[model samples]
Structure formats: C-alpha cells, structure tokens
Target: MEKGKVVVLEDRVPKLKERRRQKANRRLIAYLSFFFLFILCVLYFQSPLGAVGHVEVSGNRHLTAERIISLSGITKRTSFWKVNEQNVEEKLTRHPEIKEATVEKQLPNTIAIHVREWRRIAYVYDRQTFFPLLENGRLLKQEGTKTAPSDAPVLVGWKDGDAIAEMTGQLAELPAAVLGAMSEIHYKPTREYEDRVIVYMNDGYEVSATIRQFADKLSHYPAIVAALDRNVKGVIHLEVGSYFVPYSPPKKEDGDETTSP
Candidate 1:
C-alpha cells in the first residue's frame, strides 16, 4: 500500500507542471498581442499616413476651391483624427457669398468641402457704381462694378429704403424673361397712386404700374403687347386696367400739310 500511494503522487506532479506551462503560454501570447497593437497605434498617429493628404472642393462657383479651403481653416498638415467637421462648416459659411456649406472627412487622408454660393440676380446703382443684388435681396458691395450689367435692368428713382425693399421683393418674384424685358424702372409716385412706377421696356414701350400688383400684372405684359399694333409706340397702363395709348405725331402748323425739305 505504501508503494502505490507514492506512485500516485508522482503522476500528479507532472500533470500540475503541464497545467502551469499552458497558463504561461497563454499569458505570453496576450502580452505579445497587446504590445503589437500598441506599436501599430503609435505608428499610425505619428507617421505621415495620418496626415491630411488631399482636399476636394465641390459645388462652388463664385468662391474658388482654394478660397473655400482657405475659409475652412484646414490644411494638408491637419491630422485626420483632429479634424472638426462642424467647426469647419461654420467657418466656411461665414463668407457672405456662401449660402450653405458641408465638410466631410474621408478615411486615411482626405477632406472634402462642398459649398453653395448666392446667386446674383440684379444690380442696384449707388454712388455712380452698380452693386450686385442677390436673389434674397441682400446687396454685395464687393460685387460692384463700374459699368452697368447688360443682362439686368437698372433701378432708378427708387430712393426710399422701404420702396427699394418692396421693389426688390417684387423683382425677385418676376420671371427671368419678364425681368429681362425691362430696361429701367423709375419710381413715379402720385397722390392718387402712391406706388406708381414707370418701366421702360427694351422693346421701346413704356409701362405704368403700381407696386401693389406689379408682378401679377406684369406677367400679362407679353400678351398685352402681342395684342397691340406692333408698329405703334405707346405707354401701357397697367394700373387701373391694361391699355395702350399711342404717341401722337407732331401736327402741321397753319393748315399746312406739306413739310419743308
């Protein structure tokens, strides 16, 4: 019985040693894996691989790509992990010409910026220069040019601030074709018609209209002009009702119908 007990104790010693060996192997593998991951993370952040390599800009017109990128405050040296998309977008939108802006990050090394710029619809003459007016009724002094814009109508005599605002709003609602047909708009308010305006058309006809129903009535201008005799030059009254009054030719003096050459 003493010999058998000694044999059993001897067998248990090897089994315990094997178990210890297996545990140490697992620990070694765990340590190696952790170190490998740490090294990779350090390399990724410290190397040029994590730097912004490319910047793409889209949907920009009045503002150039370089200008948009400059406004965004992002550079090629910026780290991919450190880019703040919301902050960049806010900075880009601060430009008066940019209506909307979006910034996005592409994995590994690229930044993309998209922007929408304001549309220049017309120009208002001020201090002998024409300043660009946006579709939203905002005027941009920087967009001013020394010469009048050929494609847009020139606003004249609408000096009152409120009247100018109202006129701009009305102009915004008119179709591009209708607006293009007009050469100039002059404010000619009367006691009976306080909102009256005189519009000189590119087609050589004059229009009398009130601001209250300016856009609504001017939409019918093409039809009204088409119904009239094209050879006759006249004033189209769109205030009380739409009608045409032909300009009277010069009359002969002292019953003489013949003219001197």
Candidate 2:
C-alpha cells in the first residue's frame, strides 16, 4: 500500500524454511544426546558395573586392613558413586590409635582407605605389667610379646599421672635415634626441680635432666656421647648444664644405686 514497498511470500519462503529446518535439526540433536546420556546412566547404575567390588587399605601398622576397612564402613555393597569420601575418613579417625586417615576411589570399582597410626613413644609399668605410652600421651595395655625391650624408654616410679603425660610428650619430640638409645627413665624429683629425672642409656651411661626442655637438651645426646671418652662412662648431667661427672671410686654411703658408680 505504501510507495516502494513490496510483500512477496515466494522470495522469503526459502529463507524461512531453511531457518525452521536448522532449528529442527538442533532440537533433534539435543534429544539424541539426552537419550544417549540417559541410556549410559541407566546401564551404569542398574547393573553391578558401578558398585564397589574391592577395597584396599594401606598405611596402617597397628591396625589391620580388615579392621580399618570395617571402621570405614566401606563394603562391596556400597555404591561407588554414593560413597562419601569425607564421611568415611572421619569415621576412620575416630579410633584412638588412628592419627590421620584418607579415602580414595580407585578405578574398576575399588575403594582405597589410607591411615596413619600414632607412634609408641614410651612405656609405663602398672603392677609389673607394661603398657605402651602413645605419642598422644595415652596409655595402652597390650602384650609385651611384640616389644623388643629396647624399643622405648621404660618409665619407673611414675606415680603422678601428669608427670607421665608430660614425660610421654617430651619423649615424642625426641628423634628416633635419641629415643631408641634411652632404656629407662626413673622419676627422681629433687629439692630444686620437681621434674628431675634419671635416665639410663642403652650405651651404659646415665643422664640427669628435668622434664622442662628435656627434648631440647637431649637432642645433643649423640654428639655429647661421641665427644666423651667411651672408656670412662659416668653421669651426663643435663639438669643445669651439659657436663660429665665421673662416678667417684670411693663407695661409702648406703644410698648409692647399684648401677651408678
């Protein structure tokens, strides 16, 4: 009706048809993709392919694989996709011996659980029965059949609970070599220091140290022993300062220890 204006259905027909065809093709492609995805999900979930078939436990010493796996609550019936990693790990760390735990899912329907148990820093005696003192300062009663007798320090005359706890804490900080060298630790509270302790070394030597800064001072034990004359073994006093006091040859008092000179 207006000047220089024209409406022709034939001219626009091909363009409109082409656009509609392209849109239909996109819709068909989307439907096919969704259909194939649904099929895959159904096959995976409906059959035993997606279920956990095996469990692997590692990094455990005091605890067995079966025990750790049981604690993690992971069984063959547990769904691979439904297994919550965080939940299983938290469950494993609930035990007193377990210090850390991690959960990982492996390929081909397998779940892996990794754990780290606390170290046995020392031992204390209760009515002649030996108990392991953990790095966390907890006492655990177990058979001494597994112990080599020289594995850790034996705490004697440790009547005070707090003293034993502090001693365990100190022993845990020592290096493996230093801790292994110690055989016995007797609680001998002196007038000046209540935390005074007498340590008997495996190398036929004695050490006088207080509970405070015990680990720091004891770290130089290997060097101190190395510098001292091995032929002349006496007492390595670490309470006030690092010095070697040779045992006096004159034995006159009844208070002398059988082991000390």
Candidate 3:
C-alpha cells in the first residue's frame, strides 16, 4: 500500500511541473507581444505616416488655393496630431477677401481647408483708380495692375462714409443682370432729393433714382428699357415713378440741309 501511494505522488509531481512550464511560456509570450507593440507605436509616430500627407482646399474664389494654404502655415512637415484646426482657420480668415474659413484633419494624415470669400459687388473710383466694393460694404484697394472688373459698375462721386456704404448695400441687393447693366453711378443729389443718384447704363440709358428705394425701383430697369424705342436714349426717372424723356437733337434751319457734294 505504501509503495502504491508513493508512485501516485511521483506521477502528480511531473503533471504539476508541466502546468507551471506552460504558464511561464504564456507569460513570456505576453511580455514579448507588449514589447513589440510598444516598438511599433514609436516607429509609427516617427514615420511620414504621422505627417500631413495630403492637403485639400475648397470653396475658395478671388483668392487662389495656394494663397489660402500659404496663409494657413500648414505644410507637409506638419504633424497630423499637432495640428490646431482653429488656429489654421483663424489664420486663413485674416485675409481681406476671406469671409469665413474652416480647417479639418483626417486620420492617417490628411488636412482640408474650406473657405468662403466675400463677393465683390462693385468698384468705387478714387484718384483715377478703382477699388473693389465687397458685398459686406467694405472697400478693398486695388492691387498690382488689376483694372476695374467689367462685371461690376464703377461707383463715382461718392466720398467715403455713409453714402458709399448705402450705395454698396443697395448695389448688393440688385439682381446680377441689373448690376451688370450699369456702367457708372454718379451721386447727383438735388434739393428735392438729397439721396438722388444718376446711373449711366451700358445700354445707353440713364437712371435717376433716390437711395431710399434705389434697388426696389431699379429692379424694373430691364422692362422699362424694353418698352422704349431702341433708338431713343434719355434719363429714366425712378424716384417718384418710372418715365423716360428722349434727348432732343439740335434744331437746324430749313436751308441747313447740306447739298450733295
């Protein structure tokens, strides 16, 4: 009986040793896996994969994509994790033409810049140069050799403050066709109408309007001009109501008709 009990004990010892060996192997593997993962994370952060790989810009006009990107101060060397989206957006919006801006980052490295530029509605002429009037009623000084845009009418006879602001606001509300049809605008205030303005149109018609209801009345310009004789050119008064007076040619004596040479 004693010999059988000892034999059973000896068999259990080898089984216990095998179990311990298996547990140690599992621990070794876990340690090795943790070490390998730590090394991988370090390599990833140091590699180009962590850097900005692509940059895309959208919703930009009047300012080029390269200009916007340059203003953002973001480059390929910029770390994707370190990018401050708000800072980039603020930097971009600092430009005079940019109205709003947004910056976003994508994982595994991509950045996107979205910008909204102020719409240029007209030009204000000063000192023989044309400055752009934006939709928000701010004027932008002309740069380089850029001339007045043909799409917008030239604002003449306006000093700086409230008159220019009022005119630009009115111009912004007009339809694109009406705005484009205008060639020049002169502030011709009269005793009866202190806010009156004379608009010289590209179609060879002139408009007399008050700033109080300028856009509302001028919107009907096309229809009014359409009703007139094509050969007639004169002022169309829009302050009280719409009317046209044809320019009268100079009178000639009966004998003034020249004989054939």
Best-fitting candidate, scored by lDDT: 2
Tens-place lDDT per residue, model 3, 61-136, is 6778888889999888888888999999889888888999989887768899999988878888888788888999
Cα displacement (angstroms), candidate 1, residue 213, comes to 2.1
Clashing pairs in 2: none
Model 3, which residues run further than 4 Å from truth? Answer: 1-31, 142-146, 226-233, 247-261
Give each model's whole-structure lDDT: 0.85, 0.87, 0.85
Question: Worst 10-residue stretch by lDDT in candidate 2?
Answer: 141-150
Candidate 2 segments exceeding 4 Å error:
1-43, 141-151, 245-261
Model 2 Cα lDDT, one tens digit per residue, 1-261: 885687787999999999999999999999999999999999998778888999988898767899898898877777898999999989998988889998998887889888998987887866766777889877776544344356788888999988888888789899999999999999999899999999999999999999999999999999999998787779999998899987755445788667755
TM-scores for every predicted model: 0.69, 0.71, 0.77
**Rank ordering of all candidates by lDDT, starting from the highest:** 2, 3, 1
- Model 3 RMSD to the real structure? 6.0
